[model samples]
Target: MPSPVMPTSRRADGHTSPAAVSAAGLRKSYGDKTVLDGIDLHIPAGSVFALLGPNGAGKTTTVQILSTLITADGGQAQVAGHDLAADPQAVRAAIGVTGQFSAVDGLITGEENMLLMADLHHLTRAEGRRITTELLARFDLLDAAQKPASTYSGGMKRRLDIAMTLVGHPRIIFLDEPTTGLDPRSRHNMWQIIRELVTGGTTVFLTTQYLEEADQLADRIGVLNNGRIAAEGTAEELKRLIPGGHIRLRFTDPAAYRSAASALRETTRDDEALALHIPSDGSQRELRSLLDWLDAAGIEADELTVHTPDLDDVFFALTGPGNVPNQPKESAR
Candidate 1:
C-alpha cells in the first residue's frame, strides 16, 4: 500500500481526459508462481478497456486488485482518482465489480438481491426501494422481481447481477467474463447494456474469453501473455500487428488472371484457381493502389476480398502454445 502514482500525461484520444484507472509496475505472485509481472495500465474515463488473455494469465487477479477485492503484492494503483492501497474504501465506493461467477442470491428474489446491495451501500429504506424498482425495470427483470433468482434464466440472472452492481452508482465497473454461458442473443443484449453504460459516461474494465466481445465493445484492447502485456491498441491496430493481412483477387478467365498476375509482381499466385494474394495492410491507400493497377492493366477480377489478422491470430501469436490453458473453445472466436 504505497502512495498511488500519478498517471502519465498520455491521453487515448489526444485530449486531456482524466484516467479512471491507472496502475504502474503492478505485480502479484502466488507462492512461487508469478501471475502478473510489473504491468502498467492507463484507462481513460468514459471508455471501455478490454483485457484479453489466455486462461490463468492473471486477468482475474488484475481485476481483483483493481476492484479492491485483493491487494496487489507490489504496485501503485489509483481507481476513480483514489489510491488503491492508501484509500481502498474510497476506491470501493467509486467502483463496482461483477466477477466471472454470478453473485445473485438464488434463495432470495431478484428484488431482494438488489435491496441487499442497496443496503450494503447504506441507502435509506425509501431510496433503496426506489432504486430497486427502477433497476428491475431497467434490466427487464420487473416481472421476475418477486420470484426467486434460482428460477431465473442465466441471462436474466446476469442482468440482475449487473443491476445489483449499479445500486451504488459506481463510476467505474469491472466486468470479468460477464457474458459467459449466455446464448448469442443474450450476449448481444449484454453488449448493448455495456454500450449503454459507457454512453452514460461510465468507465468499464472488461476481461473476457470471447475475442469477439472485446473486438466489438472495447474502445481499447490489451493482450496479456506470459504475465505481461504483449500488445495494446484498438481492434484494428491489434490486427495490424500481425503480418497475414492481404488482398485476394480471383479471375474466372485464365488470360485475365495471368495478365493481372504479371502486372502485380509481389503476389502469391494460385494458377489452378486463377487467384492472387497480394500483401496488404487493408488500408485505403493500398486498396486504391491495387484497384488502380488493375484498371490500368485492363484486367478485371471476378472477386476481390481483404483478409486481415483478427484478434484470434494476435492472441495465438502472442501467447504461443500451452499458455491458452482451459478457456472455453467457443469463446476463441
Candidate 2:
C-alpha cells in the first residue's frame, strides 16, 4: 500500500506546497461596519480551498479583495505568484472568477458567450472559435451551442459560466456559489468539473452556502465569520472538533439493550429506541474498545453504526448570535 500521508496542521492538501494564496492580518470595512477584522488565510497550490461564512460576513469582500475587484483597507495578500497590492494585474491575469450571479448573458448563444470571453482574453479569431468549441463539448453544452442562454436550465447556465471563465486558462479560479440553484445531478456534475480542474493542477478558492459541497470537494475548508477565520481544517478535522460524534449500538430486544447499556457505562441509553449512544469519535481505537468490552461482558448489539458530526454543527458553533464574531459558515460551490 502507498504510505499513509499526513495532512499539514493548517492545510487541506494531503501534500503541501508554497501557498497559492496567503493573507495576514487582513481587514476590510464598508462605511462603519467592519466586514473584515484581522483575517488571515493560507491556501496552497493545486487544491480546493473553501471559504465559508454567513451572509454579510465578508466572504464576498474577501473574494473581491483577493481577486483585485476592490482594494483592501489594511493587511496584505498574495494570489497566484504576485502580491495583491503590488501586482493586482498579475493576479487578475492568473485567476478566473465565476461570481454569485450567472455571468452568462441570456441574450447570446452559448458559443457566442464563450467566444466573447475568448475575445476578452485577447485570443485570435480562430483561436477563440477553437476554445469555444472545445469548452462547449467539455461542458456538455454542444447541443445548446447555437441556442441563446435564456433557453438553458439553471444548471446549464452555471456550467456555461464556468466554461467561459476557463477560456483564459487561469491557474486559479474563484467560484462564488457557482452551484447555487442546481439540482442534485447538476450539482454533482459541477463537482466533477471542479475535481477535474484540481486534478489538472489548478487552484480553486470557493465560497458557497452548501456545507455538503465543501465536504464533497474541498481539500481544505475555512469558516469565516464576522470577517475572520473562526476555524480551518479538512472535513474530518472539522467534524472531529464538534461533539455528539459517536457509535450507535441498536439492540433487537429489551434484554439485549439493557445488557449492553449496563456493559457500556459511558453510553447514553434510550429505552424507547432500544439503543445505546456511545459517546466517542468513530475512530478505529474507539471501535476496538467498544467491541473488546462487549466481548468481555458476553453481550452483543444487533446492529452498530458510526456517526460523525456534520458541518451544520460546526456552522452553528462558530457563527451563531452568541458567537465571538470570528466563526465560519459552510459555503460550497
Candidate 3:
C-alpha cells in the first residue's frame, strides 16, 4: 500500500497536531432535532473509514461537520492533524470533498473544470496546466477534455468530478454518496478509483446509504443510528452480530431432504421450497456440526451454500424501525 500523506495535529504554540483525524463526543443538531449525538470517530492517516446509515440518519451532517463545511453543536474533531474548531482552514486545505452532487460545471469543457479547481487552489499557470493534463489522462478524460462536460456520460462526469477534487493533492477526502445516480458499471469504476486512493495512502471518509459500497471499500465501518454510532467494526464482525444467518443444503430428492430435515430437527424447514435454513452465526463449528449431521443421515445434499446476513441485515436491524424494507437497495450504491 502507498504511504498516507496526512499530517499529525498541532502544538499548543502553533505547530500541527499529531493525529491524522480524531474526534471525541462530537454532537450536532437542528432546532430540537438532534442530528449527531456524542459521536466519536478516529481515522488513521492512511485508511478508509466508512460511515453508514439510512437516509436522514445524519451521515451527511456528520460529513459536513468533519469537513469544516458546517459546525458541530458540541464535541471536538481533528482533521489532517488540525483541530477542527481551532484550525478550520488547515483542515479544509488538507482534505478534499466530493459531495453527493457533482461539482463539475456542465457548460465548461472537461479540461476547463480541472483548471478551475487548480485556480481555486492557487496553483501557478504552468503548474495548473501540468495538473489538468495529468488528471485528465489519469481519469481517461483526455479524449473528452475539450468537450463540454454536459456532453459526458454519467460515468465520465463522475470521474471528472472526483479528478478535480484531486487537483490540490489533498491527504484526506470526504465522499458523500459519490455514485448515487450512476449505473452499475459507473459505480464499480468509482469503487476502483476509491480503492486506488486508499491504496495510495489517502484517507477516505465515505458516507453512503449503500451497504455494498462500505463492504467493498471500507477498511472499517461505523453504523450511525439516531445520531450515534450503534456499531463500528469490520464488515464480518457486524454481520456476525445479526441472527437468521444460515447454511443451505440442496438435495436431489424429497426423500433426501425429508431425511435430512428429520435428522437435523433443530434446523428451520422450508418444505414447500425444498430447502432448510439452519440457524448459524457463520462459524466453522456450526458448519462442521452440520456436515457431521448430514453424514450421519446418509443423505447427501446435491449442493450447499453458505448464507450470511450482509450489511443490509446489519443496517436495518441497527437503524430502522426493526424492519428490513424491500427497497431493492441491499447496500449497493
Candidate 4:
C-alpha cells in the first residue's frame, strides 16, 4: 500500500471537478497470473465511468481492489477524499457496491432486507424504518414491501439489492453488471434509476459487458484487455478512433452504378449489390460536398446511407481476442 493522492480531472460536461476516485500504477497478481498491470485512473466527481472488458479481463478484479474488498499488489488510490490504503474504513464508508449477483435475502421480506442493511450501517430503529420506507417507495417496491424477496421479480430483487447498498447514503457507487439478467424494459428502468443517482451528485464506477449499456450510461469508458487498458475516452471519442465510417450509395441500374463508381474512384465497389462504399467521417461539410459532387456528375443513387463507427466497433477494435491464463481455484470474482 502507498500514500494516496487526489488529482483534478474534467467531467463530460467540460467542467473541472474534484476527483472522487483516483488511482495510479495499480497492479494486482494471483500466483503467476497478472490481472492488472500498472493501470491508472482519474474519475471526476458526479460522473459515470464505465469499465468495459471481456471476461477474465480483470474488470471485476479492478472493482474489488478499488472497493477495498482486496488489497492491491501495488498502487496508490483515493476515494471520496480519503486515502484508500491508509484509511480503507473511511473509503468503505464513502462508497457502495452492488456486485453482479443479487445480495437480497430470499427468505426475508423486501422491507426487512432493507432494515437489515440499515442495522448493519448502525442506523437507529426509527431512522432505519424511515429510510427503508423511503427507499422502497423510491424504487417502486413499496407495494411489495412486506412480500418475500423470493416471490419478487428479477427486477424487483435487483432494485432491492441496490436499495440496500444505498442505506448508508454513500458518495460513490460501484455497479458491476447491474443489469446482467434483466429484461429490456427492466434494463431501461434500471438505467433511469442510475441516471437519477448521478443527477443527485453521486459518482459511479461501472463495470459492464454490455456495450450499449456503457454507451448509454457512461460519461467516459475504458476498455481493458490483457491486463491493461487498451483505450479510454468518451463513447464518441472512442468511436472516432476506429476507422469504419463510410457512405453507402446504391443504384438499381447497373449503368448508373458503373458511372457513379467511375466518378467516385475512392470507393469500394460491391458489384453484386450495386453499391459503392466511400470512406467518410460523416461530417455535415463532407456530406454536402459529396452530394454536390454526385449532383455535378449527374448521378442519382436509389439509396444513400451514412454509417458511423459505434461502441461495438470500438470494443472489437480495441479488445481483440481474449487470452486469459489459468488461475488458482480459490480465485473469485
lDDT of each: 0.90, 0.86, 0.85, 0.89
TM-score of 2: 0.90
Per-model TM values vs. the true structure: 0.93, 0.90, 0.86, 0.89
Candidate 2 residue-wise lDDT, 32-69, digit = tens? 99999999888878889998889988898889999999
lDDT of 3 at 136: 92
CA deviation > 4 Å runs, candidate 4? 1-6, 11-15, 253-256, 295-298, 322-333
Ranking by TM-score: 1, 2, 4, 3
Off by over 4 Å in 3: 1-19, 253-259, 270-275, 296-299, 325-333
Per-residue lDDT over 1-333 for candidate 4, one digit per residue giving the tens place of the 0 to 100 score = 554455678655887778999889899999999999989898999999999998999999999999999999997888888877889998999999999999999998999999999999999999999999999999999999999999999999999999999999999999999999999999999999999999999999999988999999999999999889899999878877977678888889999999988878789999999999899777778889988998998888898888887777777777875623222111110
Q: Which 10 residues in a row give candidate 1 its minimum summed lDDT?
A: 324-333
lDDT of 2: 0.86
lDDT of 1: 0.90
Question: Which candidate order results from sorting by lDDT in descending order?
Answer: 1, 4, 2, 3
Please write out the lDDT profile of model 3 over residues 218-244, one tens digit for every residue: 878999989999999889899888877
lDDT of 1 by residue, 126-207 (tens): 9999999999999999999999999999999999999999999999999999999999999999999999999999999999
lDDT: the better of candidates 3 and 4 = 4
